[model samples]
Target: MTVRPPQNLSSLSPNAAVDVLAAEIRMEKAISLERTGEAAAKAVAILNALPLDDPERPRLLAETAEAVWGYFIQRELMGQSSHGAVIRDLAIPREVLVRLGVRRMP
Candidate 1:
């Protein structure tokens, strides 16, 4: 299953939209690697490269975080311990969650 960014992301500046799209692509690749218990360093790098002040940073961070969580859940379900650990280690920081408007989660 190929993961894609929201179409409405086009409403952002061209450069911002492109950055988000690139991050989404990396996220998809990370998901594919996770299926085989591989690391997702490239995805993390892509997401980390997004500028903090970019208008689309929050959206892109949220989307990438969701994709990472999805991969983590899938690995957990499949009993892939090491891979799940890797995903967990790459989790989005709490500051990013706050930026995404997630005040808190249970």
Candidate 2:
């Protein structure tokens, strides 16, 4: 998996975050040739099940952060540069992560 920032993300502007992520994920899907109507529908179903506004959202953030970070670290260990590491390790599509309203770390 090629690592990339939340797609099209130039800044952490909260308003445009979702758009950036979506573009990024879509690009990934295209590059990977994983585009399919069934896959898209399944992704929609899974996303719809997640609670986006719960007060305990931190738990979700923490878990996702760990996973993404681990992916970066693992890729680095495998000889990827920092940029490549990030692109390879991110799990959630950039779009969904931004839709979850995660503020990127400074």
Candidate 3:
């Protein structure tokens, strides 16, 4: 199923509108990744395109970071490179991690 943003975003609160847009963008990127095996670049591009002032930005960043981290862990369990270059390349910001309650390693 395809996901699309609300047509009347202006009718919604700013936070709600941003949340809806972020969800749609994430869904599209995930579908693209499943079809093309190119997620890191697309994910980063989508995240970077969001306005810095959008309230949903941090939530989107945290969710994307967790998804990428899980993907890397799964790949490592399958004997792929444990040190995922893509994960490193994404380099989720420490602030986002903290917001998500993910502790940084020493």
RMSD of each: 16.1, 18.6, 15.8
Candidate 1, residues 20-104: lDDT per residue as tens digits? 8788877876667565333334445567887879897766676555555555556656556464356356664555434433332
What is the clash tally of candidate 1?
0
What is the Cα-based TM-score of model 1?
A: 0.43
Candidate closest to the true structure, highest TM-score: 1
What shift in Å separates residue 84 of candidate 2 from its native position after superposition?
Answer: 6.3
lDDT at position 26, candidate 3: 72
Worst 10 residues of 2 by lDDT: 32-41
| lDDT of candidates 1 onward, in order | 0.58, 0.48, 0.59
TM agreement with the true structure for every prediction: 0.43, 0.33, 0.42
Q: Write the per-residue lDDT of candidate 3 for residues 1-106, one digit (tens) a residue.
A: 9654467886788789889888987777566545333453455557767898999886677665655555555445445664446546656455443443353454
In candidate 1 the C-alpha lDDT for residue 48 amounts to 82
Q: What is the C-alpha local distance difference test score of candidate 2?
A: 0.48
Record all residue pairs in model 3 with backbone atoms less than 3 Å apart, i.e. clashing: none
lDDT value for candidate 3? 0.59
How much is the lDDT of residue 73 in candidate 1?
55
lDDT of 3 at 10: 68
